[model samples]
Target: MDIEYIKDNYIFEKLNENHNLDDFECEIEDLAKFLKEDAWNQQNMNLSLTHVVICDGIVVGYVSILTDAMKLRILEDKETKDKICSKLNISENNVIPAIKIGRFAIDKRYAHNGLGKHVFRNVMLSILDISENIVGLRFITVDAYATAFGFYVEKHKFKYLKKDQKDVDSLNKIIKIDPERSFSLYKDIKSILK
Candidate 1:
């Protein structure tokens, strides 16, 4: 688990038909299952695009991303909404283009090193490139697990999406599976605007 070695050696490659994911495990069952079983199928379905960090023909980490749009009105936390408005210089009643990190996980073996943060930086960098060239995306969103709260919020500056009652459907579905689910969280791209 040499962080510098990984940084110098690992390459981000699009998940493809030839890749064998049998040994990829992040110790989080759901995340591992999603990568090994669902990622390719979902990619074929145009649901999400997955990328793997490979080093010496092994998968060290992976992330799945997809297009997302956030309706500003759903940001019920007044302070959060106001901050977003002031930073992006926009009203709080329109749709803001975004990209969602559908899934993000690092291998269990790479847990304690700086690899997770390194991989996340790659994610943001890739999104920034896309934002500059392909689209004018304004935000980044994630359905963060409770265990990931500190990682997304404190470490990465993500804030909870404080939607009103109208956000019940998605909340309910997540809550049904894990009662401690954190619902949704977002990072304003304006903070890192190019």
Candidate 2:
């Protein structure tokens, strides 16, 4: 498939009544099913904004984003956190402001065709737009599955949030699904655009 043609033709929009979600399918069952079943409801409830990728009127992929708060766990030392706060001109707090990519998946038929990265770039750009309007959202965070760790970390250059055992155990209890493999990665919005 021609990249520009696909990029130009595909429709990216918020999930709405006109969109059909039942037929969406991806290699990952959970991700596909979430889009087909729960995405619209979540959007309707104002929990997340699900952006669907459509080509020739068929749903090819989707991504969801939501305002989120994360702890500054990447900064291990208090001094580091303090310095960052000083640099940002914000008081040090338990939670750091963020925009989370809650769900991201492409249809099975479209896998391995570079559409995922295309859609991801759009997601980041949209986050940048949001950050421009809303202050204090400095980071974009993703809790990537083991299968997607390389794409987010290696390809996208998102930093993994390093944690000690206590933090790991706490995260494990909170995540409760492949916690050992789940990666909490983040990138500064400004850094990404740069």
Candidate 3:
């Protein structure tokens, strides 16, 4: 699997093939709704740093990072946010930099190819690279879907904070996975970089 960071609209459009949302019974309209009002935003454009995974040049899975503080605040609560800040060791005056992973859809055909791990590793690499240059980055956060929470916690080692029951209820009503929460898996990028 090849993970490429593509900014082109065409690449973003290709995420529909064997889309992850479809696995969760989410439709394009639902995605549009989230993007319109719920998705992250930064500097006017959606606050999504997207990564596309290709098998033989075909887009299979994709992941996005929400780096906008305002948008993140709207999604997570004050306590959860403070925990993330503590993990990153940032002062209150500094802008809270976070990495929210979304759109982690893998093509149904490529389910067993380990593409998910590849996509995650690439995203972490990018986040680490960016955090090295930035001053106030404290934590990498995700409101991981219930289906994906185990993978995030067990495989990725992200510590679960409090859950946003309201958001969890609104999104996955029947799944009955624990309520969605904020998690900070990687706290210090600078030390790792050095």
Candidate 4:
């Protein structure tokens, strides 16, 4: 599979409408299931920025950024909201500047080729570039999966905003990645062209 960055609205719409879990491998199927649910769609409907990772010209993974103030507050928990605002040195009522990596999933077939890292790097670069355009953007964040926490911390150097906790004794674990601390992981982005 060839890796390419996709930003077409029509392509993203078609991918979102036609995505199926059955076509991917088991690991990817799990990720797709979460992404395909109504809850996920509804929660991210207000996001204004989106980027899709295409392999062989087919959409396989995506990442989105939300700049909407109301939507940001609605998507975060009280504690997270406070921490985020504080970290960025913004008041509660102030328009909070944030970039959220809403969804990231790689096709099972392409998973073995380090596509996850590729997509993640591309997404980070996209966010950083967007940050330059939006002066208010002070932080980039992501709600990383518990299973992938170790990778984010050890491999990517993403500092944990809070301790790891199990919400329902399930595979899902809620954790945040602070892009400020993990900025070094993106040196490669500077070398690669968009």
Candidate 5:
């Protein structure tokens, strides 16, 4: 279960208790704290899987993913829906299987070094490999932060999950406190594997 990757001179490994998370500081204060304090506990509880990027034996970045399900309607476009259904061999009405990038961040020192793209690509590639054998996984999704929206949408080619008025209204209601903003984005796994 140790998913490892070597890219852009960094080694990626599953974040475990042995990895030093304390010094890993990303731009996002919450993200840095979560990786340092909570990721291990969440991993132990079967909540999500977190992977760290190591450069010269120092933990500089991490990405977390969870095996999850999405409603078929979560897709923004008909073509994406069709592609997913064809891959899973299920109708459009069926709930789609997915993996979600729950959290991702690179240390402040590594920002603008093109490391984020490398780490993101590795995460998607790992999910694509998992879907081939796991039978149901058809899409990779992310609740993207507002600032990183363009990175996910434009750079990574992740499509925004079209939200209806009702959906937006509900999300707005629940997100009142602190008002953290994010947009749901998805990419068809079939396209990635191709």
Candidate 6:
């Protein structure tokens, strides 16, 4: 089966009071907790907005997004910074604006299936549309968890801005347990258009 057919069985919407979020469980406890708890709180606070993917009137997965900025000077890879500047038509030392996926999770029942990718494809499309029309977004960033690092980098082509840098989205606080892992990654929105 292809991703389209799998995606066709699901419906995507912004998180709302009408959502059936009681039984939404993923492998990660924090992710599951966020969906049922922090998602609404964060949304109401204007900190982040969650997008849910539902099937059979039940929430299957979700991704929360928030605005972020990537500092070119902080990136370790000079080549990547140069490419970003050249592609976005900006200076190498400028801070580029971006959208960040603050959290992403798939329900346990939906895990190991292709629904995550399906949901991600739609996200890319939505962000791409927004960037082209409503806003001039240059990148889609994510502070991906250490466990799912390979999936984002290999499957979605998200690249690390710097291997040694701490997670910037943590807002000046340190929550990371592993200093060796660089989970802050980004995908150029322009690259998706191409």
lDDT: which is higher, 5 or 6? Answer: 6
**TM-score of each prediction:** 0.84, 0.81, 0.53, 0.55, 0.82, 0.83
Candidate 6 local lDDT, residue 29: 80
Compare the candidates by TM-score and give the number of the best one: 1
lDDT of 2 by residue, 1-194 (tens): 45567777887888888987778887668898788788888988999999899888888889998888767646544554576677867665557789999889988877777888887888888788888986668778888876676678677877766573354445535445653356677877777766
Q: Alpha carbon lDDT of residue 125, candidate 3?
A: 70
Better of 3 and 5 by lDDT: 5
As for TM-score, the candidate ahead, 1 or 4, is 1
In model 1, the runs with Cα more than 4 Å from the true position are 76-80, 83-90, 163-182
Look at candidate 3 and tell me the lDDT of residue 133.
70
Best-fitting candidate, measured by lDDT?
1
Error of 6 at 98 (Å): 0.2
* Number of clashes found in candidate 2: 0
Report the candidate with higher lDDT, 4 versus 5. 5
Q: Write the per-residue lDDT of candidate 5 for residues 41-103, one digit (tens) a residue.
A: 999999998888887788878888898777876677788777767876888678777889999
CA error at residue 59 for candidate 1, angstroms: 0.3
Please give the TM-score that candidate 4 achieves against the real structure. Answer: 0.55
Ranking by TM-score: 1, 6, 5, 2, 4, 3
What is candidate 1's local distance difference test score?
A: 0.81
Task: List the global CA lDDT of all models.
Answer: 0.81, 0.77, 0.49, 0.47, 0.77, 0.79
RMSD values for the candidates in order, in angstroms, are: 4.5, 4.4, 8.1, 9.1, 5.3, 5.1
57-100: candidate 4 lDDT, tens digit per residue? 46566555554223234422456557756776766566545556
CA lDDT, candidate 1, residue 180? 52
Off by over 4 Å in 2: 1-4, 75-83, 89-93, 164-181
